[model samples]
Target: MFAFYDLETTGTSPAFDQPLQFAAILTDNDLNEAERVDIRCRLAPHILPAPWALAVTGISPDQLVDPDLPSWFEFSHQISDLIKRWAPATWAGYNTLAFDEEFLRQSFYQNLHPNLYQTQFANNDRLDLMKVIYAVRDREPDALKWPLDDLGRESFKLDRLAPENGFANHDAHDALGDVEATIHIASVIRKHAPAVWDQCLLNRDKHEVDRLLQSGHPVCLIERFGAAQPRSYFGVFAGTNPQNNNSVAFLDLDLCDASIIDANDQDLAKAVAASPKLIRTIAINKAPNVFPVANPRSAHGSLAQLVSAHPEFHQRVGQALANRYADKEPAQHVEQLIYDRFYNAGDKRVLEDFEVADWRDRAQIVAQLDDLRLKQLGMRLIFSNAPEFAPKKYRSAASAAIRDRWLTKEPSTPWTTKAIVEKQLHEIVCGEVLNMDQICALQDFYHARISEIDI
Candidate 1:
């Protein structure tokens, strides 16, 4: 059995406030409501929600000031009784995994009924519908209409969807009225969209199960483009995050929520190790792309510095840089120049693969990077891949370049590469297939010249 639930709160913190109103819809197989409940209550000292909460929910303080105030504690008891009687496998709400369950648990704790959090009652029995829609369904922006009070978004806005679906929400702050709206929408979706229904149920324990199946499990492999961008949470998607959050990592590991488990949680560590997607935050530029030229470049600081240090490859790097000036060229000329200057210092394979214009732009960046590298000041990173390659800061020029190359939405040339790199072109391509974002990463990777940091 599954329960579709919604709660309106007097405040954001469940630890501080009780539900002003709530709705729960019980369903078995189809839209046939095995059971449904909607409850509202007047405010009291125990549930003295802050003034801001009342204003946000649009529920009047006068509404709860009545002498015949409803007892929410008793109402919560009714809910516990229903759960005991029904023994539902799961209950779902939009963002319920993150927001609702925490609020409910806090309410239970404050009311001296802490065990209400456990499913059967045990821990982690609630499903989050918001995650379900994102993982399985296409996240096209315009799919939804603008909501009354807020901008309509695909990920976490229940208000955005409710109005379009016919159960328009009047207040974000009222728990019972919110419930009435929640249950109505859940009922409508269960009757109409079974795919989203099943997806909501499955997301209670797993993330991206359906989308993974649909795409044959394509993981977003990362490569950083510039130094200013830091390792973002998006790094979690590919593997263990690069952010200095808990300060623990192994030779291999998986990535999960830092807030949910301890750093020493070996079980969680093992789980990460066993996964195929080795999530790791990658730097785009040589160093963090700290703007304003105050910092030294990390990837390829300067040709003069590099040449002065190595001295032997000076002629070759100069030649590669000069190739940018060449009007028309053979693939060999490009390869030879890359071999001379950028071969050992950074991954300059992209220079050999990009169109003339991009190649020229890269040469300029490379020259700039070499200057930074010469100074040995690295760029700063801001973002990490949490199942997606989100950089700390996306350099507009580089991002546009990447988007154009992979999305192919703009005019571009079929940039040719040297012979050795293209060998076995027809072989079945291994490594997980690239996502739209990952494809951009590949383009960024080829173009970016960065020295691998050994940490």
Candidate 2:
């Protein structure tokens, strides 16, 4: 089973923004639809929608706070129940691994569920179609209809790709419309390039990845970035480095490109950290975003070429990796546990107890937590679910910052005021940014809007 999901949110910042709508499509192994869910909730009082986001999504404050809509708590519970029912299945989406996944995790946390279980369970895994699309383009460019932006760069945005590729996307920003487009795109890939699709699906299994990494051979890696397109490279599983217990680092074959490979150990150590080459590291317990290099010839030549060409390549890479973080300060306890994937039995009970506790009891529970990581995490939960209950003395600087940001008021833009509109019109006439006829039309529209205002 594969669960394809999408979210429409108030803004881009996952830490501060909240979801307004959610859509999910459940399909069998072959991409046949089995179930679909579309949900919307009344906007929480604490959330303020961004103006640009509102323009793109076309969801007004009036619409979001409609009395007929479900409450956020009820809506989140429904989403949690649906995901739990479909557990032990692969969760696939375009650009979701980085964006939607975080939103969903935060939602679960705010709702008081074990936040990370959906994506972290042994039987569950994740696949990002955006990454898969990058891989497909590398192998077979003609397999799918690719879109290019105005600058002629390849584009992977769902809205643009949908209409170009013959998928219906009537509601471009609607959660359900995006979900349909994702499913359609997945189906097209499976039909045109079965090999790419199959391997991507196969790699979702953690055990398969473990076996491949344990082989100590070179493999193609596809990594996604939140701000840019996906990048692929040839790398080897450079077993656990000095990062953490579950840390896994990849040795980039390109790092041996004559510079560091020939340098002495001392120089190599500093060079590796400074090198622009990517040394991909991930948590071993988490689902890997990389796939096996399908065609060794086209990728980074043969594995033998990477090995024998530089005899000391392996040793040099190890030296660089070992010294990379030798003197760096460690992460905070809460962040370290998140990186280490160290949730245990006690933590589970703590989460359950924290969720159901009243504000006073919740504060008491947070105070009593012995584990520094759990205590920090518990304070965050308190701030999210019961902010009024959080003790002033225990609140961290970071927590205070988030609270300040969420409560801060934004001033209205100049374009929204009549005084600014008249000034802008004068500037436009004098500056010649627009013609006289265009300025006249704009003034006419402004007057008409003003006349229609109830005030």
Candidate 3:
């Protein structure tokens, strides 16, 4: 059983923030509801709403006095009791783990003793609904990608599927209101994305992602709008290095088998795929964004091509093109270009190349991007709904091109940025570096994207 939580707080951090109100939805499995609760405490002077938080949650300073619960101490006791009794192994909320959990913790710490709520929850199972949703939506359709608030009047109903369903038109920003909403979303997920649900089950068991990948099971990589394009990059696990065997191999190092010279985050790997257990063995690591995962599956061997050719784009204006003119016929390029757009894989500026005399021919190229292709490609490009905050899937065919030039041991020019970035990212994610040949392939990759990017 997973207890879904959402907290409305006075501020933002667990160490510094305080939870003014709270909500929760207990589910046995799938969307099956087990329990529901909503509580609001007396609003304190210092706990007054911050303007930005108020506007986002639609909760206000005055509402705190309205939804009176049994008592502060009593309810705190009640919360502890509920958690101990149900003891849900996983608790998830949209951005709640980071924002809600911290604030709730700090609030409890300030109000209660060191023992009451803090001790009971420090070991409690936790999940981040926002992270999961973002992951799923990254592969979703463009229309269905954004949250309801972002869409504003779109068909997606935030309230209908949320606290309204559990608390019956109760306050939205209150802790309990948000918790109910979180559970509702889980129900929606059971219906909309079964694969993610399955992954959740694995998560409950604390399954390792590397093991899942090595299982050789078909990973959907499905995107929104029913578009799917699949490719497999199996780690060649042969030779003397038993550690790296069955893992991604890089230029000279076997990521799975390579020694962790200096690293911090284990899961956010670099060029190869190795267990975080291995990463913990080394010390050269930094934060997640700085490290970036480097899985063979994550990177493109062809990245170096794009970086070298980026400057050469000016020269291609007159030279005979290859992809577009395949024996003077256009077939796969159009399909490929459309596939790259939703993923943000293709370069937007490249559309200028489609500027030919015949508009009909250009229109035909546009047709190849049909909805299905976009969904598949979008899934590959986006790993999470919040791409900037979270790691993305596709490296924009452009990044792969850049990677090739950077790894040549030459002083980095504009061309080397991609490879350096790729090497760093690959190390962060997979805990390995790029292969020499793969690094060299970036130059060609540059030309390839130039040919296919845009219309």
The per-residue C-alpha lDDT of model 2 at residue 257 equals 46
Q: How far off is residue 278 in model 3, in Å?
A: 17
Better of 2 and 3 by TM-score: 2
Candidate 2 residue pairs that clash = none
TM-score, candidate number 3:
0.41
TM-scores of all models? 0.41, 0.72, 0.41
Which has the higher lDDT value, candidate number 1 or candidate number 2? 2
Runs with alpha carbons beyond 4 Å of true place in candidate 3: 44-75, 111-124, 140-177, 205-455
Best-fitting candidate, scored by lDDT:
2
- Which model is ahead, 2 or 3, in terms of lDDT? 2
Clashes of 3: 64
| Model 2 residue-pair collision total | 0
Report the C-alpha displacement of residue 347, candidate 3, in angstroms. 59
User: What local lDDT does model 2 show for residue 446?
Assistant: 46
Which candidate number has the best TM-score? 2
